[model samples]
Target: MGAVATPLLAEERVVTLNRIVAVVNDQVLTQNELKNELFAVRQQLRQQGIRPPSEEVLRKQVLERLITTQIQLQQAALLGIVVDEETLNNTIKNIAAQNNLTLAEFRDVLQRDGFKFPLFREDIRKEIIIRRLRQRQVESRISVTAQEIDDFIATQKAQGNINSDYHLGHILVSLPDEATPAQIKAAKNRALAILQELKSGADFKQTAIARSDGRQALQGGDLGWRKSGELPTLFADVVMNMKVGDVSEPIRSASGFHIVTLFDFRDSERHIIRQVQARHILIKEEADDEVKPEAQLKEIRDHLLSGGDFATLAKRFSDDIGSAQNGGDLGWVSHGVMVKPFEEVIFNLRDGEISAPFETQFGWHIAQVLAHRDFDNTEEHNNTRARDLIFQRKSEEEYLSWLRKIRDEAYVEYRLDD
Candidate 1:
């Protein structure tokens, strides 16, 4: 028998131990890397209560997303770009403050979300790097002339138009993502049930507290007056036509079922701010990790309750920079001017009455409404409007330009056909 010649060609692809996940230049993406990012992604989605694909599917998606993101970031780094730690920390602090958590509490939240601190820090780092790269590389190149801003404003005003805004409140009931089809149906049914109850003389607030899964549940599902367009299309549609004290039927959304109540409909209400010449002392709620701000707020609350000068105390103790500078004066603010909770209280207050200390996205505030006024357009107002228009136009141009450059320069490939 003749000796058989050996075939050098392998019939199949062999996986290499050296290939952890996939390497882009020197950056090696590992399973652990994908896991960390995916953990963060799932945490964010979970907070929104959004339903996504299975963990396996999400892992694949996160891996792809990170890889694409890394490409953009790498290109940015090549331009000798970076973000300052102070700015990044402040950004995180602002986000935490929006959720009413102090820095420590916010850290706890990220920890509980199954993310390592380094993972979160790196997430922020990359975001800042991309942002700085975009600003330095792209945004700095884009500009809108002052004349353009003026022209846009004039054109808008020539339409005899005030920017359209709606003042309405809502009651929302959300369902978990892991919910079954029956559960979704049940959620909708419960929303309908709430509507029926409201129509049958049940208190809207009471129903909301008992049934809503959203954060609005705490305030009885009172969304407390947002612009008409700010709401989801479905919710916005029903509320726009309805008069005050109206209740909506079950409104379906990806987040689950929603029901809205229109407490008041004020068009151009935002432009004509109902100003309350009020002073306030704040009392931040005391959590163990956040006692100082809280204790300070409580002391202020006690003093106000005991008859200290609201304005005087506010100037000294209130942390509201704009208002504190003016003796805790929030100059005439439109419907959406203040945070939702504070706005509700301000609008509800009759002039000269002090409110009970109320907590908002900010630390707690105890506001006093000295007076209320309708809006007037003065030269100052027009100038202020013009400046705002300029900022908005410039910011948008910069933001869009930044996004386009990153997205266009990104090199992405999909291994899975889907």
Candidate 2:
């Protein structure tokens, strides 16, 4: 009792190389904790004209991101969002699979880069918490009206842009910031030549596969489908209004330049008429070798066809809680509010009728057409939808602002002195 071992002495007595840098409430952020994030930030800066900050600046940024994360994570906890251990492990495995590596191999690579496995696990855990919290706070509250989407399209038309931008793939011949004037000129010339070849009937994707410098160049310049606001202003402006098979004139930007071709567009064809409102009950197919959502839905369909109560059974069997609690009511979703496959079947059904089992991204759904009013230029309905649209957009803006404020107010300390 008289001789007490100090923590400094105890640490020295053990084989400890990493040091704890910050204590966020009950959580500990260690030196090796932020190594991967710091490395990523450094790499991103180098890709731009920005040089890597000193060890001091990188440390500060890493700690700030972590602290911001911690505060949000705590908020998520307050909202009852907790990432289960199994979820964390599954997320890691999924990430590893996405990178075309086994989980063990991914873990090995992370360890080689000075990142501790537990620290990475905690980072992933925090991300899961943040997402789960947002799903409740934001996604559950998210609602889009048919008028909102239509007005958005109308605005696009007013701007002389494509009302819907297709999945336009591009190959960038960017001049790296450190490139010499000669190198820059050569890159620009290479871009101009690519444009010439494209105009002269060369396969744009083939040339992109051969010569583009952007990340998606290897995937034949495929950027996948994007909505109007999802792309850069200049390129998005040109591509949105162009028909399929249209190519842009050599487009120049700060990141060298690019040539774009709109090879495909998948505008959601299943928009609900503005006068319609709907809800649904879903019985998902279990994931077994022989069973599927369709099979389960078929049984439910028999019950409904026999005049079984829709609302009563919805409470008992529907998997979607957002709607199920209200007797499988989806409230009012405009046409594009649903996935195309589901909406397509629902749109064809008459009011008070039940849809056949339909497959969508979220298992199988058997929808009820509760109400639908014809929209043959109804002024009142249009105005209501317009208001709903504006409200939805305003909510999205408010949520983003809230997230940013949380980020800015966090108390962050760093290990720059080390």
| Candidate 1, 100-181: lDDT as tens digits | 9998998898788666777688788898887777667666766656686567557546643335444555666665545689
Best by lDDT: 2
Q: Which residue pairs clash in candidate 1?
A: 166-228, 283-297
Residues 1-418, candidate 2: write the lDDT tens digits: 4588888877875524467677666676776556666765555445433444357545654665666567778888777888788989999999999999999999998788666788778878887887777667776777767766577556755864433436887878865445678987888898889888888898776566566766454455777766555565557668766778877777775466778888887644323356356767776666563756687678888988998888888898888988888888777666666788977877778888888887787878888787776444434343454454455545544554466556445554544355
Model 2: colliding residue pairs: 162-240, 162-241, 271-335, 272-335, 279-330, 285-293
Worst 10 residues of 2 by lDDT: 267-276
TM-score of 2: 0.42
Candidates' RMSD to native: 16.9, 14.1
Model 1: lDDT equals: 0.65
